[model samples]
Target chain A: MNSAETALFGLPWWQAFVGGICTIAIFSFLYKENPFYRFFEHLYIGIATGIGVMATINTFLWPTVLKPMVGADRIPFPDGTYAEPYNEFYLLYLIPIAFGSLYYFILSRKHNWLAQLVIGFTLGYGGGLAFKATFNEMLPQLEDSFRPLYVAQQGAQSGIDWLATLSNLVFLFTLLTALSYFFFTFRRSEGGPAEKSALAGRWMMMGCFGAFFGATIMARMALLVERLEFLINKWFPLFFA
Target chain B: MDSSARQKDSLAERLERIDRRVVYLLIALALSLPIIFGWKLPPAEMETADSFFRVVDELQPQQGKIVLIASDWGPGTQAENKPQTMIAMEHLMRKRIPFALISITPYAAPFLESMPRDIKEKLEAETPGETWNYGTDWINFGYRPGLIIMIQGLAKASDLHEVLKTDVSGTPLADLSIMDGVHTIRDISMLMEFTGLVSAFNYWVQFFQADGYRPPFVHGCTSITIPEAYIYYVSKQIVGLYEGVAGAAWYETLLTKKYPGRESGTALKINTSLAVAHVVIIALMILGNIGFLVRRGDS
Candidate 1:
């Protein structure tokens, strides 16, 4: 059967009816805040959280921890294939289980230090990783910032490579001025070069922020457009068509 | 109060105090009408998206070159990230490229599996006698915790099969036919990250690509994150970037161009709606500002 004939989630017409109601209920907030919108909002959050928990257990916990430890006799396949798995080394996982249980000691006044040990170790490991990550992440960007303001033509017939030089020059100027704007070492005189460059940097930063704001507006509009599309194209047609 | 004075006050004051509900209604109408009536607006192809298509277009199938998809998005960003994920999967499947998916965010695991599965099923239905078997075409590693560390492990591991022990279904990674020649990070031809969060792209770049492990990288991100990602693209850390819905629409156009008769999907419809909505917003902003300026002049 095609989409129109087939039932979504096995509920025939009720699926579309319920979905249309939910969409309208959510969109009802345009007029004013109401019980309808609030109800669906809460419903969405609750459903999302419940689904997240179940998925985490079924996908992450089962395969990574429980199934590996217990060694199920039959592997549950989506296609209904039964596979054998022998039970062995179930006890080894208990070590980490016991160690992780130490996290509960934070509830106690006296044994809170035990929990602190785990926290400290986790922080230290994270800090070490961050140290390495910072260098790897920032260095390439820093290196790439060094652009040549002039370029010689290799194969192209274009004369003087003016655009390439202008692009690099603008990048260099923006980088320097932006950095200077943040320099709080010693106050410069009122009309000094330092102050002028700093002012330029402020304008450039504002321009950058404007671009960011424009992009944000576009992204938000995309979300609105998508919801409207769902309501009009997908949900509305059930009754109207 | 005199009639003329009252008229001026009402005009400017009413403009300033126009109920937000009216604005919301206008926005809703602007977005809904175009979609309901089936209006089409072609999005301009972006340079970033063009570069992204070029990279994926270069890939040859079944050459032992795998693509790694780092999917880190969830329901909150389904509008943007879902289309991005779907189009990328469609491209990979169409090209017959072997790819593996892994999610760092726990919430994204189901999406990582389900979206690709849906696309695969749809493609199978459309093409006659074309087969995309689970084990042979693609595999999912599902969700792994330790976002940065997990990527680092994948990057440094000599054998990817040992690192990623099993697929989402609990089948051993070694059992999949797609995993035949895929043994290490070196086997990956390209890495594409479809993310709502910009930091996930940073982790991939910092841990995987920038550390002298040079697999060509591409990013598909929410429009909010696109500006920041431009730095990486300019720096050559990423070969290309796709910016939200418009980018996805452009990618779909390219796909249709390559393989004619492909259906213009949700991306195109949403892109047109977005164009209308943006115009409405800008007009409102202008009108609001004009009211503000007129009130200031009167005062």
Candidate 2:
């Protein structure tokens, strides 16, 4: 590959080197506190927050709010290719959302009714959807909870998938025991099997926690790797040694 | 530190050992070596991952309907969520189903916010020959605050046009023919949520289902917050679940199965890094346990 192409994709390159240096610099805080790492960290946060705000406004408000409200023809395109005339009534819907934003202003100054309007609409909308989703999704799920302990289908490709059955039993046991462990309505025997099973359930949950923790660590590590690649592969190739 | 003194102690006492600094150094070396040498490992599919793939496999072109992807994860989770989102979008694009992208997360707007309009621009920029247009193939409902509120609005079909109309760049939802007949969240075939929050799944289930919406739901969340999700999965709140990097790797595998050459190189790099990391952590946990046992024996 040409030097330009090498500079573009290779390690010991510009973006990759810069990104790696930044990553290492950020990680250095683990060993000792330093102002340089803190500065880069803060810059990262600020840039991310700024980009998020700009992107949201560009994507959501423009098309959903301004385009429909002002009519699509008003929003300009680079070559004037996307100017489509739109209906006018769409502008009326922005009133509630605008009123909703006014709730933040009320936090510093207390007029209960102003905040209520936003909360009422938000809750009403959220409540209505939550209600619908509960039955449509959860009711069927509740019914499925009564599944047979085991099922056998003819001509199954795998002869008795033990893990499937075992996993189901484990799932069922953990669910019940965990629920029992939190049974606060009535007092429990101090050292019975019920308590023992509950303890087992607690341990099971801990095991799951360990796995989850491991996966989380991997995810964070992956993020670090990506950043390092950006620095090493794209930013600075000279420091690869 | 003497052997005669150690022998008098219990097994746990003898096992209880080693300073954490030693672990820190060893872990640092383990993680750094793979990167320096470019050592990559192969990833094997797990059962949960395989089940997720089977669900995607079932959603082929013959289904004649597209899945709805609610990508509420942005740059903060770009490392984890971006790969899955890209793979999911590629799948939908290849299947010829006109999928829609929506976001409820405040942080995630940059990636999908101008996507609908940008998709049109991008298509024009890349492939001008083939016939394609916005609203016909894909629609992006721009980022909305009030996470639960927006989801509810979706559930009830209230102000479907209004909701779509309020997009950031002022692109009306009605401008697209693909959205012409759709009024509610239930109108879509399946709903896939890629989030870092469990509340996203919880709010979706409680509100959307209570409203008579019956689309099968799938979820992808950060690994740390996924065990609780697995419980929900056992209870059947979510049809399939993909947690963190492993889930992303599984999704990549499925994507490769369908579209062989679309961004496989990056996926491979990701899978390699993940495998190496997982191994590193498992070793750390083992070392941690061994140290604990040794210290206990000494006591």
Candidate 3:
């Protein structure tokens, strides 16, 4: 569908107008802090918050929880048998519902401890899961870290893959040095192997940070380019096209 | 030397403390002029994005198998993720592979509709009569609640039809022709996730691996998280990576090479703009440094 058909959001041209205005209002902050930027910023926050709440409830909670409990999801035959059986187990959703409701108790002055009960339960559950998740995510990286120093490709006699070996060696060096840099509790003398390793690690980390910072600038520039593109291609066309 | 000559309003002094607004204007003009005049050229393809394109392009539709796309970004990172989503989605469509869109972020809900429609329009414009209609071509699973919980639920679900029940529009998944043969995570041919959030990406790696059967995973990450995302790519956890808009631009370059004469995507244009802006920034930085050195020597 074209912008002409995306009128579900608003009139094709009207949406652009509103968007252009909002974009300019938000961009006004580059000059100085002003009511234009402030108003649009708050408007965006309000709209986003409202959308988040409604979408969470309508798309997730209503279908996942309430419909199951209310049998709104079930298709009943004339004889009162559901095509999809409504398991009484659906009522078990209420336990979580009740448990999650304790979060509202945080607003209460005296009964704030009630909120902590669920908070503790959630934290404990999440903490236990994080242990497994961290391991799940880390183990592969650890395994990949252990590469063959000499990879013999085509045939073992053909000769070791120097490029692969060099890459692996570089990886190992980076891994060890980066790891050593975090060994803050360890004591090392000046110009010692450990100290040198840590320094190398710092340099490598700085290089990585530099790449990250460059990427960040690129990302921000991309964003600016987009707003400018919209102003030129989409917004300007609204008036001139 | 006289005090008057010492306190001269020279070019070095102007370079040393140029107003930030002027810098912004210069940067904006550097970015905008090329776009206005159309010097936008496709960037050199990166090996990583080529790997990404090859992975998606190599996907052949099979019975009980389809791509699962996580359009897990919002307007905030639209500059990068939007093009990434488009390039990936366009490839999937070009290959005629059925796919489903899911997101853990509520903000991604609109993207689930708009991105596909954007692609559909583009495809239709290029090739008449080959329209990408919803329900048959793609299905929006919409925003699922908790990331870990949602991913884990998808992993454990024995029957996805029963689990998903309906698409974002409240249409039953069973009714959608695209949902045919798509039953479990096993049927997911490839899992492609595009997002700006590293934590969300982490959850996919952490929880999306169902029954030890992780379908070839690919990631399109925002520039901020590209450094971290590489770990997954290098670890062989994700088979491919789109590093940012740069990655997407490179992938688009590859696609344009494959299918010449099609209207080029905005990734290349935006990327070119970024290149020009980088040049302007570098020049400014050089001038500023020169000014600093000159002032120090004078002192």
Candidate 4:
């Protein structure tokens, strides 16, 4: 094993101590909600918020907006004379900034119309994007929904391909029935075909929900496992291992 | 009551009234024991991970073809996304493939900044003679504000250098050897997005792929997003996907298969821990249901 690997396993004693304490504090919620956990939780939130603000300002605003406006170089004219280093046209960036600032006007009773202008514009723009997004994103998936019912000889050369055909058939059935379940325009009697199909659709939806819930549990467990690993392998190793 | 009858009564009633703390402690123990004991498991290879690996494996390094890594995950998803990113980075570094990392989310910048360092150390340790330089091999474009707008800008920009003047470290894009032929979205060989949000995946598809400049797109998403992601996968929108930790474990197994002696990293360990934790949870559920049935019978 390399020195780096050893160092990774053998974290400094103090670091391990702090990590262990924090891990315990977070895990203390399992026993009951306590002050230590609450304190650490608040600290985490404060640090996260602070980092977010600084990252936004430093990484996004400073580079894209501030620097471009304040640090533009002057272009030489035909007469060999130079204008101001920063371009005067860059001042136009303030227009959007001014508009964005109008959102703060929402606090006022009389001038809340100014805030609505920004809100309206944002909604209009977002809605347009959403319209475009719905087309581009969903349309292709809609097209792909057209799966072949029968397998071609060349396509089903392998057993796996035949299984794929069966899977596609199942998919098509599920899709149709699920759509039927959502079709609430017409009411159907207990023994009607539509009612039966809708019932199947409900079952299919439940299966999908079950899969989703299982995935969610797995994801959460993965996170918990990671934290536990850190505490056990990385943190406890300093003293115990 | 007889002793056997009393025992039967207690078994049903006790399980029904089991403390939440006991369950929590069991879960905690189940997760921690595997790690503490250094238990390991062989991860099964999946078609999804194989598809993802095949794309990266086929790429020729040092050919001016670059992968754009759209990192849209934060600390909340580090357990899943971080390992995915690390594995991808390790593959790229080993192959000497030049790539650019960019983030649209606010919290992703700092998290991604630490990646290159980790990759560098791993590469140096694994391959002693091989070298990977920052500007020449990879570049970090920190964080951008707009998701859709940024994707649109990438697609529409005539000169990517002009659009993105400096990288995360305030270095000029023109100075980076990695950006030699990478000028626009069309120049990108492929895109691998590791995101926690389904909306980000949709935006990537809407702006980058469906907007005409279609690169081979791969997605690594949280397990919660996998159900939604399968729709895109079936639609052939995303060429490959890694569905959280299980997917990551599969990829690691593939990596180990491709290059022997590669350490089975956190993914495998976490997968085993998760397996045990899941069993405990399932047992708890089953017991709870049994208790419910018994209580109902008594009523």
TM-score of 1: 0.90
Model 3 C-alpha lDDT per residue in residues B1-299, reported as the tens digit of each score: 67765665365688889899999999999999978987776586687898888888888977668899987888899999999998999888888898999998899998898888888998898898877889888889999888797888897789899888899988888888888888888989999999999998999889887777988999999888889999899899998999889899998888888888667788888889988999999999998988888777777
Ten contiguous residues minimizing lDDT sum, candidate 4 chain A: A152-161
- Candidate 4 structure quality by residue, lDDT tens digits, B1-299: 77976777789888877899898889989988888888877766678878999999998875666899999988778888888888887788778888999988888887777898877877778878877888988899988877898887887888899998888988888888899888877789889999878888888888885346689989898888899998888788988889888888899888888889676677788888888898899999989889878868765
Give the deviation of candidate 1 from the true structure as CA RMSD. Answer: 3.7
| Model 2, residue B106: C-alpha shift (Å) | 4.0
- The superposed Cα distance between candidate 2 and the true structure at residue B86, in angstroms, equals 1.4
Best by DockQ: 3
lDDT of 3 at A97: 90
Task: Give the residue spans of candidate 1 off by over 4 A.
Answer: A1-9, A12-23, A73-90, B1-9, B209-211
- Model 4, first chain, TM-score of 0.83
Accuracy of chain B in candidate 3 (TM-score): 0.95
Give the distance in Å from residue B2's predicted Cα in candidate 4 to where it truly belongs.
Answer: 4.6
- lDDT for A209 in candidate 4 is 99
lDDT of 2 by residue, B15-60 (tens): 3454555655555555445556666565566566566666766775
Name the lDDT of candidate 3: 0.88
Q: How far off is each candidate at the interface, as Cα RMSD in Å?
A: 1.7, 3.7, 1.0, 1.1
Where is model 4 more than 4 Å wrong at Cα?
Answer: A1-20, A72-84, A153-162, A238-241, B1-3, B295-299
TM-score of every prediction relative to native = 0.90, 0.75, 0.93, 0.92
A43-92 in candidate 1: lDDT tens per residue? 98898888767777876667667866776625677876557545567658
The clash tally of candidate 3 reads 0
